[model samples]
Target: MAANRIRVAKDKAELVKSLVASKDTTGPFQTYVEVMVFAAALGVKNKKRVPLGETTKREPSPIPQENFASLGYDLIIKLLGINETKDINILSSREEQDEDKRTQIFEEYANAGLEILQNELRGSVDYSERILLFLSLERDGYPSEKQEFDLRSFL
Candidate 1:
């Protein structure tokens, strides 16, 4: 089955060009609608594939772990891969909508590093203030670089 497959327009660059070059829509909905219409006119149904399951290697794979640690904000954001939005929303959800989720994310970040900021962080303060306060605490209190990074995990 794999041997019979004819690979056309390989890679994202070709895919994007193909999308742009073809615009055969009728209504106010422009690009995407036109694309769909073109496919429908040609009696082309969407291509289905066997599910990749737990081990599908998607394109544009993650950067090396060593590289991830160097990027700004990547350490915290990437490492915190997939948490529910409820837990990490001090800035967005100040209305007490989902403080528990935000708190849980905070605690998780704290745990990943050594700072363990759950106890020290004030509930009343906002995200920006917490960041500044955390930095100050890390610089003054923690004499080691590792400790500083740990506290910064939250910031």
Candidate 2:
């Protein structure tokens, strides 16, 4: 059975479009799929899952499930769903309803992630640099000085 298309938040559609690299633009990602998946990953990392609000009228066009499946991203998506529910049974269910539920979960995360990206990318002239800094912070956290250990107080 064919899976349903993945939808992005309506309010974030413009942000999504602006993030993609096109002849007229110089965004980091190559395609919308990449942008969406990256945003989803960000959502997962930030533990920010939000239900999708009003969607555009086929604007930006919902991506086909096959696009992700073709690139083996479906597994990553499924793993995220399983992780969220803390139930491996989510992997067993193949019903359309189950698929839709999983899709909803993914979309919600993407929506939240997009909101984060918008806030982080705002006022940045270079998206790549801003994104790299964001990733660095997410990975290593803010730099801080280490306190020296002193045992003389115990004496």
> What's the TM-score of every candidate structure?
0.20, 0.85
lDDT string for model 1 (1-155, tens) is 11111111112212212333335312222232232223222221112112112221232221232332343322333223234343434334344334333333322332222112223333623433554576587568856666444666678
Distance from true location, Cα of 54 in model 2, Å: 0.6
Report the lDDT tens digits of candidate 2 across residue range 71-147. 76888679887888887776766667677668888888888899999999999888878999999998988766686
- List where candidate 2 sits over 4 angstroms from the true fold: 1-3, 144-155
Angstrom error at residue 89, model 2: 2.8
Name the candidate that leads on TM-score.
Answer: 2
User: How big is the RMSD of model 2?
Assistant: 5.5
Clash number for every model? 4, 0
Clash pairs, candidate 2, are none
